[model samples]
Target: MSEDYQLVGSGLTVCEHDAPVEGPVVWLDSPSAVLEFVAAGDVSEKIVLARGGTTTFLTPALTAGVKGVMTLQGAPESHLGILSREYGIPCLMSVAFERGVKSSRGETIPPDGAILRLDVSTHPEGRVFIANGNGHLDVAEPAEVDAEAAAQAEQLRALMASYRGELPKGSAGDRQIRARLRTGVVSTSDENVRRDLAGGEVSDYLSYAGWNLWDLIAARQTEGESGLIPRQEYETVAFVQQWSTYARWYARIVEAIGVDGVIELGSLPRREIGTKVNHVHVWATLCPLFGRAIATELGLEDASARPEDLDALIQFGRRLQHGLWGGGPGFVASRGYAAPVLEASWLERFRDEERRLDDPDELSAFRRFNATTELCGFLLHYDCRAGLCDTGPYPLPDGGFLLVRDHFLHEPGYEWASVIDDLPHCVTEAMFFRPDEDVSIAINDIATTFAQPANYLKHLSGAVVYARDRWDTPVSEVRRLDEAEMARIAHRCDEAMLGLYQRIGDQSVDERIADGVKVYTRDMMMPYARAAGVWDEMVAAGFDELSDLARDAYPALTGGAAQQVLGAVFLMGQGLVPAEGLPPAPEVGPEALPVLHEIAIKGSCPDVDGDAEALEAAGLVVATAAGLMLTEAGHARHDELLAAQRESVDLGRLAAAYERFLAVNGPMKSLSARAGSAGEDERFDLVGQAAELVERVEPALRRTADVLPRFAGYLPRLQEAIRRVEEDDWSYLTSPSVDSVHTVWMECHEDYLQTLGRSREAEGSY
Candidate 1:
């Protein structure tokens, strides 16, 4: 057939199959468009185009209904890519149009009602052709789920539905814990919130924490506090019900997957889970010994001045009598599920009737983990810091541990949390370092040291865990530390903490720390403070150290101000930051174009007064209450520079780099997703994967940087993030607020796309 058609555009095909599909392009650029399209019904011939890969949530209802999907952004690693693959839909990502008429949606497209054909026979690249023929293609029916898989799914769902446990009561302690969890939730972006929504049962972990805390709080009180007490009581019952639900779900998974699955699941990662469980467990196991210690410390033995507080404290011992056995949150959150499940033949080896503190193994492991565990007192802002003092029977070369008994709550800290001191020399050495000889740091949330020292010696400087490696190391070994040995270990811990801040000098460290702090403040603390009704008080207190932290987070702006400037610039780039009653933008010429480029990249031309003035004079930037933000003209100018920059790039070489990048991209993303729910040991392994990924992608990044020097910044940034992970600052792995490994990796990916003059939509990444 001599078909008369034009090759107008092409994209990366999501699926590797041969199927040609034809449909009219329907741009779903907004939520209303999605709603309207879904309402239209029977959209079997409409191929929907969206700007982002994450638009899957919006299009889930439309996915089965549509003929095909063509996204402007996102790669095969994207959620939409995964969904389309699952549905066996013909999807193309990052389509680039060579020539086309502008549509009402502001993107180039073929004429209205024009039929476009997607030829996806090729492995990677899919071709687009405009052919003169009636648009008729048979819609493929949805695939049927396998009978066994369907039954398994049903079984899981049934377990989820059968929970009817009692809820725990609420207290001031519960409120404190909730505040921290809420901060984490509120600090995240809207995009992440949507991801959590898509995550289904996994997101319910937060709910379990909330309800369980309330129960604990209520249990602490001697008598109910009327309205508050009743509410706590109801919430406690609901909490127990949720706990029951989670327990059933976990137990069923264990039963189906067996002991192997249980080992993979490991312990829960949340600090709060361990803290809450340890509190109840320790009180239950050694209340007489610990209760007397606490009474003496709080001076409550005589019960003179604070008899009510003492009585309430004593009530906790009785209220939380159920020892930290198999029914706590840890059971539901962990792999073993509950004690009953442990009795199964496959898991019988894991069962321990001597699981309480009296058992040496249980006691040792508990101290190793919970020594630094802390909590805010009943209603106080400062930490109660009531956890065990230190973790070790850590043996020295002379067969003694360099243990410090005092400050146990904070002494051993994160540095020794996961250290397996008693492992065989060879096994411990293998666990301490990666195969390539990089020191393998353990996963501990409390360790916040970021970046490695520039002139550094590599060694196992912090806690290290072998989560996957099965080992039995008795905690009963008693060791003594000479003064010299004790001092040596203490020095090592100090060195571990000292990194970029000291090595690179305060300015760069200050700025870098500020960047992380800025993200933490804006995304997490501010939202939390506001939610907790303490924002005003914080502001009144002059932001204290927060002001110092935020001030240097971003690159310094011109006019001697940088407060909220990055946020302002980000908003302006998006065409909004909640502006009102602005003055009209001024007109300018090519004279200010260079200055515009500088301001665009550096955020501000602080050193050059003329450059700053040129940008403002060109109406490219506007001053606001926060700081200087880019104007519409500024964004247009920046885009122009970007286009010009792309013209000089070696497209072939950059494309090669992108292909290489794609090789490691999916693995990194998958690792990150898994790390979200994985235990500390598993996360440590994931970090090892991340380090390997960084090495693998370095050459690709170098090739791109050779073409565009600006691209060079990514490698070091990524390395620094991974290095932070090595030092036990786990947030550097994926935290959006900071220049984390994932963040830098993605930025580098986008830079490559931009340099090659490709739209993220066409590339299928957003």
Candidate 2:
């Protein structure tokens, strides 16, 4: 990296819109944004003022005199890449720009530094120029661009100007949200779109409301709108996102109130008769994961009794992320999962029962989660006004995943017809809030909340029976450990899990050893099972690959009732099912860079209909079996999807992917030169080769944006798991390895990236 790079500027500035309040400056985090910037019709050939260090592609902009009329806003290393490879330009981030801008106009640079003189090559039409390595900048000569491109860029710039005003201040975020909300012509400069893509209250509401509403809006405008992410769909993601908005706020409220902030909810003004509720309802109906003794003691149900009872409930609340909302095994007789029908002969009734609601497996949990999420939505609406949910997406970094299955999750909304279960609104409303104000608790609060000794004894009762198939240890022996170390281990494991869960739920969970175990148990083994199953099933026709792990896992554990205990452990692990298969990228091959990028664009998964073929046909490459099969027309469908998005991105994800692409291609001088020739465009030429370069990367870029964060997000969690394994605590591991968050998050994300044009072959790793 050099200390000095200079840009010489003529007196000129060009962009379709009025100047941004701070004076518009380019901040390139992604190559896609670079492409978009050139395609925006905002650059002028007359000015060549470089503001920062140079980078590979940006050099020509300076050399062609489009460089540094104003300011450049990136780093020196990045700037240098754009410099020596092309012509030099002055950029503001440069020390020279600062000294020059601060000093007078007629300043001369010291002879020791690299200095560029200014020149002009203006076009009659208002077209911006960007370069391609093919001796043509992405910017085209005036005649090469089309009217539609110019008009669309203008339209987007207008929208961008408006987006800039939406943010009251600072960055606006709420998961994979802003991208979903983007609609209509996109601003050429993703920076411009980013400047405008902020929302305060409206975004807050939509965060809870779900992307479904956006889909709903678009659905109304379109013909075939059946496939959309329903806000109320029966999926864990919807459930998580629903409360995330509140969780974000609740975290703030806690900071504002205290660790005991939830208690204040009980004292709030009673809701009007018709007002929608928060989670208080579901909190009421669901059995506490811990049990009644604790719930009653916490002023949860207004019960007064013994010290044991008080200790029990407190333990339950403290143990689970959701405490005793649903009673544990003790209540299982009448409060937990089987509570609704334990003695009612529901299981027996299944033998002869006709097809009906409550099939036990499908709708139950899914229904419960969505019902609660929607309730949380209404509750959050009140909280925002009432002074509870305050911090933005709560801003904590604790992240995880949830599952979404079509036949299982989809259901009619409250406003739609329901052919599904006819459960009363009371049960549905139960999702509002669990018993105590502590929403950060877990459903696994099965320790103190169960009927205590009684529930423990009962669960063991069946344990004795199932132990008959064990690997030599008597059921009585394993059950002995339950009594001997049950509560003690329960306490230790409780502390660890609770610590992990709270951090994760609040998104404030540290990426430390404690959370690492969570990632491993949750991410690795689980995902291993998932990917194994999918790979096996797809590779063969048998779904039996899952059976081996199921068998091997229990026998491997030490204990008599080990199977039963393991089953329970598995259930606890079940909550993070979708994330089970996450694994870091396999291995990508460097020489296969273009193919890798194409694979990343067009998914490697058979289920995907990504941009592989399309990007290839559009001058990219597809080096995978799945990609080669897609027709050019099929690829166009991929283009249509990307073009239809209505949101803005920092383009950081795309940059990472492209950077990965660059790394693979860095050595291939031939391809790099070819890439240089056609990739960068100068003037806004929507239909010509210049436009084609932008077009080739846009969908791939969007896909890069869509999936990478999900991948990037898993790193801290993964590192934490590595730390945990080193500690060797036999406690339940929730991390991505062996079974952790990072594992699945990585796999799922990598899988998506592979579908895009980025292939593993090019990167030299999967």
Name the top lDDT candidate.
Answer: 1
- Summed over model 1, clashes come to 29
lDDT of each: 0.40, 0.26
Error of 2 at 695 (Å): 37
> By TM-score, how accurate is candidate 2?
0.16
Can you write out model 1's per-residue Cα lDDT over 343-459, one digit (the tens) per residue?
133122112111224445433333322111111010011111122122112223422222111121121112222232321111110001112232211111111111112101122
Instruction: Report the C-alpha displacement of residue 161, candidate 1, in angstroms.
Output: 46
The deviation in Å at residue 525 for candidate 1 is: 13
Off by over 4 Å in 1: 1-4, 133-266, 269-766
Question: Model 2 off-target regions past 4 Å?
Answer: 1-175, 178-212, 215-596, 600-766
The C-alpha TM-scores of every prediction are 0.24, 0.16
Where is model 1 poorest over a 10-residue stretch in terms of lDDT?
A: 374-383
Evaluated at residue 627, the lDDT of candidate 2 is 27
Question: Could you give the C-alpha RMSD of every candidate to the true structure, in order shown?
Answer: 29.3, 32.8
Tens-place lDDT digits, model 2, residues 531-605: 123322322433212222222322222223332232221222211111222111122223333333333343443
